[model samples]
Target: MSNPFSYPTTPHVRKHGPAGYREWENYRPWLRDEFDFRCVYCLCREKWGRRRSSWVVEHLVPREKAQHLALEYSNLVYACSSCNSAKSAKWVPDPCQHAYGQLVYVTNDGKIHAKNADGRKFIRTLALDEDDLTNYREMWLHILQSWKKHEPERYRQCMSFPDNLPDLTQKIPPNNTKPEGANNCCYQQRKQNKLPEIYG
Candidate 1:
């Protein structure tokens, strides 16, 4: 059985300012912690992307649909650029409550299997079967297999429960200054590049 704690259904306890200038900055850390730095859809991380901004605060229910929930912590999701762009304004099975093993499973072929009709719809909606994602999962599978064989201790640690997980934190110099970028413009760029427009 998949670990329940692997995905979150509850909102983080951290304080997040209302949606305004740089409000997401205050909530980013909380979302990161809630999702364990993985995309709710593809499980991708900023570390896997070309930029730290690759992962973003995607609204589970798009702000266009529910403007009131724009900054509602419970409605926020941590998603990678591709998944976020693909899921711009559509609804899918909530990864938190609906991501149990049967609904979404990884097959031996390193493909994501949406076991039910809803799962199939979700997969189709997000194009989760794309070759790049298949190959990405396969690569990670191989790496995991190698780790299990050659680095049992590390593998065990990686497989441990979230509460039992070790502290992998590292200190970095503080930067309280805000970045000069308007983060939301990336979605417009993606749409202009002929990516599917979900909001329209």
Candidate 2:
């Protein structure tokens, strides 16, 4: 489902880079397009944010185990900030903590595939087939359907939360850049801080 062409390579990553960096350079846009920039796990739209960077490129098998299979498109996917971070460098789950062994990474057709038993355990431990995430998938499905029905209003709403009137308003002025610059692209900071300017 990956579109091989749209991927971009960073200069540093093009030379000497970690597997994560290389995989992200060549694989991110492809996966983003394939999955519509939605989290492969939670099904939420993602943006590149500061604070250690969000929306990480997740590998089913930790890089060490994936050396031979690193380029396998099916083995790579996009994960949300929390999910990817929580899974840091792990190839699989701790089975002793969860029953039912581990759920193998299945392709779109739902075939069992895994690099090791630990991977299976990781899946099981995390409840990778979580009902919450499934519900999120359905939520994204509804959003897609709704977007097609009404573009203008939906687009406005989508541009509202996480963003706001001031950020992109015409009143911002010509030749004037964002008051706080790129890192402040979203109002997430205000929202996160529960600032009076945003909440009040």
**Which residue pairs collide in model 2, if any?**
92-118, 92-119, 93-122, 102-120
- Candidate 2 vs. true structure, TM-score: 0.37
lDDT value, candidate 1, whole model: 0.55
Model 2 per-residue lDDT tens digits across residues 27-73: 55444434435455433454323222477667767677768666554
Across 1-200, the per-residue lDDT of candidate 1 in tens digits comes to: 23211223342332222233235445565456455556777765443443224778888888889988776666777778787777778897665566434456666456887668886888777777788877776775665567778987655545432232112122111321222212212332343563222110
**Count of backbone clashes for each model?**
0, 4
Can you give the lDDT of residue 69 in candidate 2? 61
lDDT of 1 at 116: 81
Worst 10 residues of 1 by lDDT: 164-173
Error of 2 at 173 (Å): 40
Output the number of the lDDT-best candidate.
1
lDDT of 1 at 123: 76
